[model samples]
Target chain A: MTINFDNAATTFPKPVSVANAIFKAVKQYGGNAGRGGHKLTLLTSEKVFDTRQTAADFFGAQTENVIFTVNCTHALNFAIQGIMSNGGHIIISGIEHNSSARPVYALAKKKKCTFSIAEVSDDPDETVNNFRSLINHNTKAIVCTIAGNVTGQIMPYKEIGKLCQEKNICFIADGAQACGTLDIKMSDGINILCTAGHKGLYGPTGTGLLISDGKYHITPLIQGGTGSSSLNLEHPDILPDGMESGTLNVIGIIALKNGIEFVRDMGTAKIFKHEDKLCRQFINGLSDTRTIIYRSPGVEYVPIVSFNIPDMKPEDVAEKLDQQGFCLRAGLHCSPLAHYSMGTTDGTVRFAPSVFNNENQVESLVKTIKKIQKI
Target chain B: MNMTAVSMPSVTLAIKAKRMLNEQGFKCTVKRAANVSENGCTHMIVVNGAPEIVIAFLDKYNIAYGKLLGDAMPQ
Candidate 1:
């Protein structure tokens, strides 16, 4: 079987507990949460609350502040658009994924708001200063990715959060690539945090989280039945319920609780250590000078590394690697801004390690790449 | 039997109220609200404890509720 290394996109081979939880959820927890007061509905609602509480505790947020989304993109859309609804200035990092970029761009296109891109530098302070320089009187919020999806460069999110707090601007962080590997919390000055459950959390697809500190009111993106104030035509103002209209994804959510438990049991530091070791092995194992690794010396990164071979299309290299029983993501990875920022506009093959990957796999991948280079 | 029913805006808050009251030995259970107003239906946490004590607890926690209904008062 081919080893899976494209974990930055989504983790494969989910934890046994998560799989079991999914099975249990599909069989027993199928009732729509907060939809009715029946035993099944109430039981399911309680289970959903359990997951919400777990996420809240994990992120140091209140239980009501935890909102389940279909994916990280959905959460980013809710946060970015909600915060930008009043038509004001917003700042975003240069390395943001399309999730944050597209929503902000749409709002700007409709003339609902205006935005400025903050240039990220190898120096964390410089990155924060760039964001600060873009702030004006109308600056409402700053949307940033905790880590670059392609290059794995860890942004100064906490420092940026501090800047936002000092300036009274809302800080919205996309933690799709950082959550399970990095120790993050609402207390880290993040007013809002968006993340995917399928990635580092080891959950199944179609599960994400939007955690808030309850300091700001976000306009709901979709309004419908929330099982609260059923008589009124107007939507309920209650949290989580207000943001989470329609039926909740109980199966994905119950399974996500187990996924988070698995991450917690293993510990973020340990997971990072394991993945980072594999990344280091992959970087060090590549003895071929023709390999161009997209990384800087002083900057920190998650476990992802982007590389390209000279005079070769990244797609060709990825296909070659795939034939050799290895899986890696090639092309822009849906973050053209990241490629533009890293000066890799032509795209590159990304090697993203998960906790399941090991040094042997890294060694084999390096060997495969070396062989591919000769062609 | 004397009982106090505290109406909550949503099931989540009703559950929260039940958990908070039960943890303090208040012995409460959540049920669908008996009286639905024009505003809509909601959930209620029924507690067989002193109404003032229950009200005080909910107030202390700042848990939002719709109304306080009871079959009997301490007076």
Candidate 2:
């Protein structure tokens, strides 16, 4: 019984319906979406549109605002580069993933743009205040991650969005780690949201999305044939066509449609409660362990826990755990900036539980960790 | 290859100069002056083109001013 605990990176054993949907699409209507007038093409296009609508409704966004991308990195690049080119100040969290941080760093170096970084706080209110302190006259945008990919510390987005609203700064959220796990709404004041379909959405890789309120226009990153206005050399200046250029991964999108539906039927609130309960149980069982160094207490974080056993390297621990048939992620998890913020330069073993993970698996994980600590 | 000089005060100005040089079909590499304060990012552009053409391009774009680092003429 291998216990998989790396849900934050990419979900495993995706919902059966998600797999079935992909299989059916490949076996049946495997055609280019929105390209041809054929029945198969139209059917595939409808499925893609349905996926977009489901995502919009789930995230409280308008249908036209949703644009598909290859992954969260692409979506984030589109938003950051597009907004920064206009020349304005920007604010980002110190705990941002490299996908968001690298672009801002590169642009800030090139553009005469003033930028500020809001510090993360263990307390949600203080975090919001940290963000408020950084805003100034020329501030153009605020970029935040819905949750820290490393710490799983959920940001107070509603308050931050409201602040952005009052200050008239574009509010952008990197939802790669939080989209399907948390209940997000556009009416809560989110201006732009980016998500990876492979994570909590339980879809295959090669699928992502960027949804905006259409207030700020983003210039296309890659310009090529969008299948619309093929004769024109210039790119079409439209909502989706402006951003989505070239061929799309139709099979991945088809699978994501069913994945979103599976999440919708299960209800995010219920999923949250279940994962939280499992996390609490795991934490409670390991409360007595003196070797484990757990950070960020008294905050409502996701079901992701990062801890290191005293005198043991995270990678070695992960190797041992793998031998014990427990799959987990060790090291910086590609967010070295986040690890720096948490002062874990050596990295820590992270256990992120998903809805499919059960209490028995949690028990086995806790027990295995306890045994490993003693060795 | 001809070399041109432009004075860029802020990091933003330096970056803009670098981007413009790259976009205009010039092989450019951005370097930082040793004397400049390292408190923030900096960029120095070295390009291959007519000195007057490069200087004019920078001037037209309103990039910050700097002295030509060396004397060189396009072959």
Candidate 3:
């Protein structure tokens, strides 16, 4: 049987309930959310709205503050471009994914804002201190990820959030890699949290969330009908309706609720333990391999492992592994900044296993790599 | 089921209020206003149960709504 290891992109073999929910929604609850007075529309809207409350409860934010988007990147774009409209400065870490880095660079190219990347230190205090030292009067927002997507390095973002609270700067965290594995509380001083539903939340590909604390106003990325203010050409100022324009992905959102239910029922701790154990096993198995190189502290909550074989390109290993009936990702993983920081300029093979993946699969993966090394 | 109209300042607010009540076990639906008045919004929320229950609950939440009318909209 083939083993799938690229779960960081999107979890495979979704919980039965989530799959059933997507089908049920499309077949039964096929109606536009918040668009009509018909029974179907109202029922659909009610369920979707309940998902908002569920997501808010999950993210430690109020119901109204949670807004749905196409994906994590869309959420991040809304948070970044929404808050930084006036154009100022921001602080990011060396481990930022292009979701954050690319947007910041694009803004800078347009002369909208300027930013600085604080050095990532192994020591949490030093990393926090690096962020502290970089803060200036012009700093408008501090957009950082809860963990490095490529390295699984958990940055001490709460400390940075606390610093933002003290200085009144917006804290936007990309929770794509950490949301399901880690508990990101709003009390941690995160003004805005963006994440993908497929990565950790087990939702469909077209679903994501942007949970914000009702402190600052973020300009909507697009403007159109919100179903509420149909009579007026202007968009409603209320949240969800303000940020959410056009017909939302009702079927996807419905399935997302079921996905969150699966996570909630399975308990994130148990899922993390299972995936972490597999990651730890993989790391321990590779300890004796002198030619293998990988990122450290393998016992991380998120099960992402980045590594490469000496004198062999990552793509070659990935291709060979593919032939061996193992699916693994290779190359930059979309975060050139992360590769630069990890000193893997050429990139590395990334294996992100989901809760559905088991120890047997991990052993088979390690065995394949060892066999490949000898050839 | 016959329902009473709970009008709010805005249509979105009306929908939000409907969900709030529905979440509390009250069945509610969004309905276009019986008669389009210059001052009020075009939409209103129809909630089931006694008018007193709607008023007390709406007041408890500090959600403003006009007096309850029967299910039939005014011509």
Candidate 4:
């Protein structure tokens, strides 16, 4: 079997429970969720509701506050676009994923919204201070990525969240690479928590979440049938129902439920320990003279490491590794901001280990990297 | 009990108020505020109970709500 190290992009080989949960949901409850009152539909809706509650509890939120979306991008859009639907100012971190940056820039162009980027530093205090300095009266929200996907750099989002709280600015966190692997609490001044079910959470793709702490105004991105308030043509003025327009991804959501269960049972601390151990092992094994690792790890981060070889493109190294039967993601990893922040403008080869990865795989990857760099 | 209407500054708070009241065995229905119809924003939580009971729940939950306008129509 090929060694998979691209956990940051999308986790591979999801927990058996996740797969089984999807199978069960599809086999037993194939009816469309929130569409009707039939037994099948009710059963489907019940599972969906249970999953929604599970996600909310896991994220320290309320059941009514949790809304599932297509992926982290969609969730982020719901938080970013919805909050700044009209013209408003927002503060974003410089190392944010495109999921955080693109939407704001799009709104700036389309909705006349403005945003300021808060530069990051290895010191969490410095980062927090930067974010604080950037905040102003007009700043309605602060959209931050929990960690940089490319560099595995963790931001002091909690500290920044507190700043947002003191200023009454909404905190919209992009937990794509951090959720399920990191200890995230919504009470830490996080208003809207958006995360991907496929990455870190070990669920199938096409599933994501936006959990609120009952403290923010998020204008619905899409307004359509919410399976509630059918009498009124206008979208019902509620939380999840107001934001959730169309039918949700039921099967994927059920799988996400099982994924959250796995994470909860195994405990995020334990999973993170295992993944971080493997990451450090691989980091220590890189003896190649041509290899260069980026960003000094200071704060807590997920098990993602980005490194590069001199005079070689990130994609080229990834292609060579692919030839050797190892799956890894190289290039920008969809975060030009991260690359520009770390001065890895050409991008870097990223290795993100998951719970399924072991020492043998890390050894193989490290050895292969050394071998490739010597050529 | 005269059906009382409770207005909120935003939809999120209105939904929270509705949820908190329901958990306390209060039957509260949510509808858009009549004055803000043209904007299609802001909502009110309608409860058949006294406004004091509703305000107490909103305060207990730390959710902000306002007195329904004397002239505002109840849904």
Q: Tell how far residue A53 is off in model 4, in angstroms.
A: 1.2
Evaluated at residue B9, the lDDT of candidate 2 is 36
Candidate numbers sorted by TM-score from highest down: 1, 3, 4, 2
Docking model 2 quality class: incorrect
**Candidate 3 segments exceeding 4 Å error:** A291-293, A297-301, B1-4, B7-16, B22-27, B32-43, B48-75
DockQ of 4: 0.07
- TM-score, prediction 2: 0.81
User: In order, what is each prediction's RMSD in angstroms?
Assistant: 2.1, 16.8, 3.2, 5.9
Q: Which residue runs does candidate 4 get wrong by more than 4 Å?
A: A297-299, B1-75
For candidate 1, write residues A104-143 as lDDT tens digits.
9999999999999999999999999999999999999999
- Report the first chain's TM-score for all candidates: 0.99, 0.96, 0.97, 0.98
Give lDDT tens digits, candidate 1, residues B10-73: 7777888888888898878877763453467777788978678888898999788887765322
The candidate maximizing DockQ is 1
Per-residue lDDT over A240-312 for candidate 3, one digit per residue giving the tens place of the 0 to 100 score:
7789988999999989988887887787888888888888898888888854546554223367888899988
DockQ for all models: 0.63, 0.01, 0.25, 0.07
**Top-TM-score structure, candidate number:** 1
True lDDT of residue A316, candidate 2: 98
Q: What is the lDDT of residue A31 in candidate 1?
A: 81
Error of 2 at A108 (Å): 2.1
Judge candidate 4 against the unseen true structure and give its global Cα lDDT, from 0 to 1. 0.82
**Which tens-of-lDDT digit does each residue in A1-375 have in candidate 2?**
677888888888799998998888889868666454456665666677677778888887766578899889989999988877777888999789889888888888886576888988888899899999999888889999998888788999889999999988899999898877788777778888988998888888999989998888887878976544444567766656567777678889889988888788998888888888887887787889865645566876877888888889999999999999988899988777787778888998888888899999998888988998783
Q: Which model is ahead, 2 or 3, in terms of DockQ?
A: 3
What lDDT score belongs to each candidate, Candidate 1 first? 0.89, 0.78, 0.82, 0.82
